[model samples]
Target: VLAQNLVIQSSSEIRKPGDSVKMSCKTSGFTFTDEYIHWIQQVPGKEIKWIGRINPWDGGTVYSSSMKERFTMTTDNSITTAHLQIDRLRGEDSATYYCARDTMSNQGYLPYKNIPKQ
Candidate 1:
């Protein structure tokens, strides 16, 4: 149900090496108002990998070990949106991005399921 909401939501895009990019991951299917929106990177002809995680409910950011000081996180409780911004984007930043709602409770929180190649 939550996935349906995200699929229909139109997200904005960001330009490389420019100002910060803001893409929101809104949720409203379970107890997600106080949850984590985990961001990931999907490279062409490759698999998706963890990028960073943002606790929209509390404005906390947990970046990958190698990704520290590369990204930032914010949230708008009124809009139920979690936004991620990467500074000074590089070639490595050029990839498809996804956000998953994760929280202590597993309700309405389905792990990111990728499409298998045929």
Candidate 2:
């Protein structure tokens, strides 16, 4: 279920192979720095995968094992936004992306909202 009183928004992107795409997720109605922001991806016909998450309070990030090198996560407290930048885009990178607050539960990082892709 979607979280109440929280609003997350992201835009769609288009890019060519070898290019880079930076997606942004903006949040409102909550304390941006107090929550962890996570990025996820869903391929056209596959399951959703966890990309990574950033600790807004300290700017620390933890990415999925395969995505460490080319993915970067950052946050801007001023605008209440989290950013996911993927370098060297490829055909396999074509998918919908999402950003959500990491509620930190036993289940793991779950994205309550989604972002679109390149």
Candidate 3:
């Protein structure tokens, strides 16, 4: 079997509060729609934070309370890509970000597969 990996295209974004930003994640060596895509966050020197997860097949999303109001998750299966957009960003929103896949296997959700910061 081949190894699968998630690739995040954006790395480190600097935006002021109230501004909007979009980041993308792409998958390789696996069925893009077979699992869910999750977005994570980390401050300059803080622990990882769960932003939300998106079902690429149907565009369904579930967000954490911290991001529910200001964040949106989306995917385009045709392009094998997922996206996370932050709207009306807050001062505390400045941080490094990442994307991971919900393998749903014994290993569970795998994070930091692609440590894209934004």
| Per-prediction TM-score to the true structure, in the order listed | 0.69, 0.82, 0.80
Put down candidate 2 lDDT per residue, 7-84, tens digits, no spaces: 455556778788987777777777889888888877778988888889999999999998888889999889998888
Clashing pairs in 3: 12-117
Single out the weakest 10-residue window by summed lDDT for candidate 2. 106-115
Query: Per-candidate RMSD vs. true structure?
Result: 5.7, 3.3, 3.9
lDDT of 3: 0.72
Candidate 3 TM-score to native: 0.80
Judged by lDDT, which candidate is best? Answer: 2
- CA deviation > 4 Å runs, candidate 3: 1-3, 104-118
In terms of TM-score, how similar is model 1 to the real structure?
Answer: 0.69
Q: Give candidate 1 regions above 4 Å deviation.
A: 1-19, 103-118
Q: How would you order the candidates by TM-score, starting with the best?
A: 2, 3, 1
lDDT of 3 by residue, 1-118 (tens): 1135746465656666678888877667678888888888877678778888898888888899977988899988888888888888777777667777776422433333232234
Q: Give lDDT per model, in order.
A: 0.61, 0.75, 0.72
For 39-74, candidate 1 gives per-residue lDDT tens digits of: 776767887667777776667777888667777767
Worst window of 10 by summed lDDT in candidate 3: 108-117
Q: lDDT, candidate 2, residue 115?
A: 25
